[model samples]
Target: MRPISTDLDQALALLQAGELVGIPTETVYGLAADASRPDAVAKIFAMKGRPADHPVIVHIAGRQQLADWAQDIPDAAWKLADAFWPGSLTLILRRKPHVPDAVTGGQDTVGLRAPAHPLTHALLERFGGGLAAPSANQFGHVSPTTAGHVYNEFGDALGLILDGGPCTVGVESTIVGLTDAHPTLLRPGGIPAEAIEAVLGVKLIHHEKPTTAKLRVSGLLDSHYAPRTPLLVGPLAALEAEAYQRFEAGQRVALLHHSQMLQAVCGAECHAMPLNAESYARALYATLREHDGDRFDVLLLEQPPQTAAWLAVNDRVKRAASGWLA
Candidate 1:
C-alpha cells in the first residue's frame, strides 16, 4: 500500500505530473486529479470504476477563482459562495470554454466547491488549479471519511493519500444547480438546504427525482454510497422486528440505530449512532465502513427524521439502503 502522510508537497507534485492523489476535504476524502488534464482526470474514473459521463466536483482553493471555470455566475451563486464557500456546498453553474468535458461529464455546466480542509486548501493553493475530485471510494460505495478509509479502498492504486484525520462533515457537499434561472437543490449534503435558502433569501427548488438526461450532477444516483452488505432502513420498531427475524433464521445481523428504544440482540451486533444531525452525519460513513468490514449478513439502519436538519442524513441512509430495498 502507498504511504499515507501529511506531505502536501509530494501530493502537489504528483497531481502536477498528471497523477491521482487522495485529498482530504471537510466533507469527505476525494480521489483527486488535475481538472485541466483529461489524462489525469481519466485516471480518477478508471480507478474508481466511475462512469466516464458522471461529473466530479472541481475543488478550488477559494471562491475568487470561480469565474475562471464557470461563466455567467448568477448573483445567487455569489451570495451562497460568500456565505458557504470554504465549507460544504457545491454550485453547479455554466462551464467556461476551458473547463474540460471529462470534468463536467460532457455537460455544459460544472460542479465546483471550495472545501475547508486546511491540507487540501494548501495543496490547491500550491497546485494553482482546480482539482477534479469524487469521493475516494469505489463507484456506488460508501464514501471515505478518513485517510485510512481511502488507503483501504484504493491501496497502492493511488500515488498518495494525504492524512488529514476524519472528515468533519461525514457526507458529501450540498449540490445546487445554478445553470437555470432559479437555484435548484440537486442533492442534500453537508450543508442544510434551509441554511442555503436563508443566505439566498429565496426558496431553493428541490429536485425530487434523480438526475435525468438534461440534469447531470454528482451524487444523484439512486443506489450510491452502498456497502457490500445488504442494508435496510426503516422505523426503529420495524428494524428491531426484522433483526429478530434475521437472527432466528441463522443470520448474523448488524444494527445501527439513533434511537435508544432498541436493545442489543444476543447474536447480533448493535451500535447506537448519534441522534443529532451534525454528529450523525459525522459518524455515518465511519460506522458504515466499520460494519462493512465485519461482513455481517444484514445491516439494519434506522431511518432518520424527515426534517430539514436531517435531510442530508436521510438522503444518505436511503441511498445506502436502496440496493436491498427490492
Candidate 2:
C-alpha cells in the first residue's frame, strides 16, 4: 500500500476533478468530495455504502459561506455559528435550491459546518466551495480518528489522505436543527448540548431517539459506529461475571473498564479506559478500532456514568454495543 500524502495541491486537484479525498477534521477524518458536483458527492455515498436518503454534512471555510449552501438561516443558527463555527457544531437549516437532493437526503434542510482542523480548512479555502464529507469509514462502523484509520477503511482505493495526525475531538460534530420553530439537538457530539443552549439562551429540544427523528442526520442510526466483534455494555459487576463465564468457556474476551479490575478474570485481556469524559471521548474510537476483529471473540465494556459530561460518550457507546447485560 502506498503512503498517505500530505500534499494539499494533490488533494485539491483530486477534489476538483470530482474524486474522493480523505481529509482530516478535528472531530474525525472525512471522505470529502466537491459539494456542488452531484457526481462528486455521489461518490461519497457509493464508497461508504451509505444510504441514498441519509444526509451528509457540507464543510465550509466559515459562516460567510453559509448563504451559498443554505437559505432562511435563523438568528439562533447565526448565534450558534458565532459561538461554535470553525469548531465542532453542525447546523441544519433550509437548503438553497441549488443544493443537491443527494447532499440533503431529498429534504428541504441541509447540514453545514466549518471544521476546525487547519489542514482541511486550508483545503476547503483553496478549493473555494463546500466539501460534502462524512466519516471516512464503511457505513455503520467505528469512525476513523486518524489518517491510518482512514487508510485501513479504503486502502489504495482512496488516493490521497491528508495526514493531519489523530483527531483531537475524536467524535462527530454536535448537530442542531434550526429548521423547526425551536432549535433541536439532532445529535450530541464534540460540543456539549448545554453549551449550545447557553449560547442560544434557550434549552434545546433534545431528540433522544434517532430512529424517531423526522429529519435524517449522520450518526443517529441505532446500530451505527459498531465494530465487527460483538460488544456488550453494562454494569461492571454484570460484565465481570459474563467475562469470567466467557473466559472459562475458552472464549477470547476483552474487558474494557474505566475502574480498576479488582478481581482478575484469568484468560481475559483487560484494558483500562480514561476516567474523564473528555479523554475518554478522544480515545473511544481508536480504542475500539484497535481491539476489533479476530483478536477478541467478544468485548465487554463497563458502562460509563450516566451524566451530562458523558452524554456524547454514552451515545456512541450505546449505539456501538450489540447488546446490554443485566
Candidate 3:
C-alpha cells in the first residue's frame, strides 16, 4: 500500500493494472477501478463489502465517451449531460454488451457520470475508459468527503488516494433513469431535481423504488449513508429534551442543530450545522464521520425544513437516522 498523493501517473498505472485507487470527485471520494474489467470491479465489491447485486457508477471523462459503455443513447441523456456533465449528475442508460455485469450488478442498465473534479477528469482521459466507482467508504456507511476520509475507510490497503482536497458538493450525484419514456428521479443529490426538470422540459417522476423494473441505483437503500453511532432526527425541542435526559443519566451525547442556538446541557456537545441548504449538504457527511465512534453514545439531529432546496439533505438525514424522537 502507498500513501495518498496527487500523482496522476501512479493512479493511472494502478487503475490500468486492475488495482483500486481512491479518487476524488466534486461530490465525494470514490474507490475507483477500470470499469471495463470485471475482475477489477469485483475488487471494489469485495473491499467495500458491497453486495454483488448492487451496482456502481462508471465515471467517464465526459459525454463523448458515453457510447463506449451504453447503448440506445437517448436525446434526454444528451440534454442532461450537456447541462450537468463535469458536475454532479448521473444518467442511467442501456448498457453495451461489453460492459461488465460486475459493474451493473448483472443488470442490462449501467449508471454513468462525468465527475467535476479536475484530477479525476484528467485521470479518466488518460485511462481512456470508464472507472467503476462508488463512494470510497464501506457499504451502507457515510460517504467520504475528503482524501483523509477515504484513507479512514480503507487505510493503507488501497494502493493510492488522489487527494483533491475536500469535496465541494459533498453528496452523490442526482441519478436520472433515462431508459424509459420519461426520465425518473432515482435519487436526489448534489443536483436538485427541479434543476434537472427545468432542463428536460417535463416533470421528473419521483420513484422511491423502481417497482416495475426493480431498478437499483446507488444510495437508494433504506438504511444507506448511516453512521456507527445511534442517530435520531426530530424537532429541536424534542432533541434538546432527549439530550438533557441523556446528560443527566451520565451518558455522552451530541446534538447537531441547524438553528441559531440550542439549550446547552452539561457534559453534552452541541454542534451548529450550516443553515443554508447547499452548505448543509456539503457539511453533513463529514460532520457525521467526525463525531462518530466512542466520542458519543447517541447523536441528536434537528430535522431541516421539508422543502425542495433541502430535499437531498432531508432524504439523507431520514435514511441515516436510526429512529425519530417525538
Best by TM-score: 2
How much is 314 displaced in model 2, in angstroms?
Answer: 0.6
Show pairs that collide, candidate 2: none
The runs of at least 3 residues in candidate 2 whose Cα sits more than 4 Å from the true structure, single-residue gaps closed, are 1-3
lDDT against the true structure, per candidate, is 0.89, 0.93, 0.92
Residues 1-326 of candidate 1: C-alpha lDDT, one tens digit per residue = 45798998899889999999998999999999999999999999999999989999999988899999999989998898899989999999999998999999898999999999999999998988999999999999999999999989988877799999999999999999888877899999988888888898889889856544268888878888999888898887787788899989999899888888635766678899997999999999999999985578889888888787898888888878843321
Give one digit per residue, the lDDT tens place, for model 3 in 1-326. Answer: 54799999999899999999999999999999999899999999999999999999999999999999999999999999999998999999999999998999889999999999999999999999999999999999999999999988898999899999999999889899999998999989999999998998999989776564479889888898999999999998898888888989988999899887734656679899998999999999999999899999999999998999998998889889899987
Off by over 4 Å in 1: 323-326
* Best candidate (score: lDDT): 2
Model 1, residue 232: distance off in Å is 0.8
Alpha carbon deviation, residue 139, candidate 3 (Å):
0.3
Q: What TM-score, over all chains together, does every model reach?
A: 0.96, 0.98, 0.98
TM-score of 2: 0.98
Error at 210, model 3, angstroms: 4.3
Candidate 3 residue pairs that clash: none
Query: What's the best-to-worst order under TM-score?
Result: 2, 3, 1
